[model samples]
Target: MATDGQILRLAQWLSPAYPVGAFAYSHGLESAVATGAVADGAALTDWLADILRFGAGRSDTIFLRAAYEAPPEDLPRIDALACAFQPSAERRTETTAQGAAFARVTAAVWPDDLPDFTYPVALGRAARLHDLPLGLTARLNLQAFLSNLVSAGIRLIPIGQTEGQRVLTALQPLCEEVAGLALTETLDDLAGTSFLADIASMTHETQYSRLFRT
Candidate 1:
């Protein structure tokens, strides 16, 4: 469980209004929709569930846990590993941009820990500082990803607001499952199996008129 203050801080970082430019990127859902791969709310939900099971959810949650438990001296190595794991140029750029921006904003408010804070690191430290449990922190991190993905899906598929909410509601169990799994994962266990999502993200670079950044 998270202390109220910890929840508040996590909310600030995870909120869509945080100015991380999270709204501007769809994580390839836009491309997937444009190409007719994701045609409806059910399809969108399925795609997102796959991502939660095997893509960003798995990899990022592992990194978040590692950063949370790691000695402060090992942050640089973790950052390097994170940078290297991103295979797509767009994905790498997006993560770097968001992580750097997250570090900047958190630094302005809490300077002492900023130097070693990658995005996940900052989040974990904030959670720990405020006495939030690891499970809650991990769930919030995964929720942020799901929220961003659905936001992208809404735009790309042009789905109704109600429909988007439906998709999110449908994935709650899976989100909990992923969060639980994340708690026990090592960095070596981090892996992504969503090749279609990766390829779509890579293809977005050459897309003539893209609505989302990646």
Candidate 2:
């Protein structure tokens, strides 16, 4: 179980106001919306579900878990794998940029020597460095990712705030389930199975009118 301070720290790190620049990236939902691939709340939920189960979300979970347990000497190799796993330039930029930004701020506040880490790698280091419980760390990170994506969906589609919240609420079980799986997974388990989501992220790069950097 997490203490109050641990919970607070994790919450602050994942908060929208944390300065990770998460708002600028929609995780490719913008392109999906533009192409009408995601037209409603149900579609949005299914899309995000696939992503949580088989896409970057799944990969990040493995990376996060591995980083949490990996020795300090192994982080670089892990970070390298994460960097190489990105399927597209924008996807790479999104993770690397956010990871770099996270490293910058946490360097001042949390003050770790995690050089050139991807977001999941950096987050794993932070979680371990701070001695946060692995279960809480996994669930919090997954929930934060889902929340950011849901916020994007609300803006891109006609989904109301309430509906978006509903989508998020519905995903909580899957989020925990993924988090649970990540606790036992290894980097070798890293696989992105949501081809459509990957394609949408690639397609987002050329979207004529775009609302997100990724």
Clashes of each: 0, 0
What is the C-alpha lDDT profile of model 1 across 1-214, one tens digit per residue? 5578877877888899887778877888878887899999999999999988988877888888887787777777887788788858888877778877777776777654655344666666556555667888899878888988898888888888899999999998899999898889888887879999998888888888888889
**lDDT score, residue 124, model 1?**
65
lDDT of 2 by residue, 158-185 (tens): 7999999999999999999988986788
TM-score of each: 0.94, 0.98
Off by over 4 Å in 1: 116-118
The C-alpha stretches of model 2 lying farther than 4 A from their native spots are: none
TM-score of 2: 0.98
What are the Cα lDDT values of the candidates? 0.81, 0.91
On the 0 to 100 scale, the lDDT of residue 125 in model 1 is: 56
Q: Pick the candidate with the highest TM-score.
A: 2
C-alpha RMSD in Å of predicted model 2 compared with the true structure: 0.8
What's the residue-level lDDT of 110 in candidate 2? Answer: 61
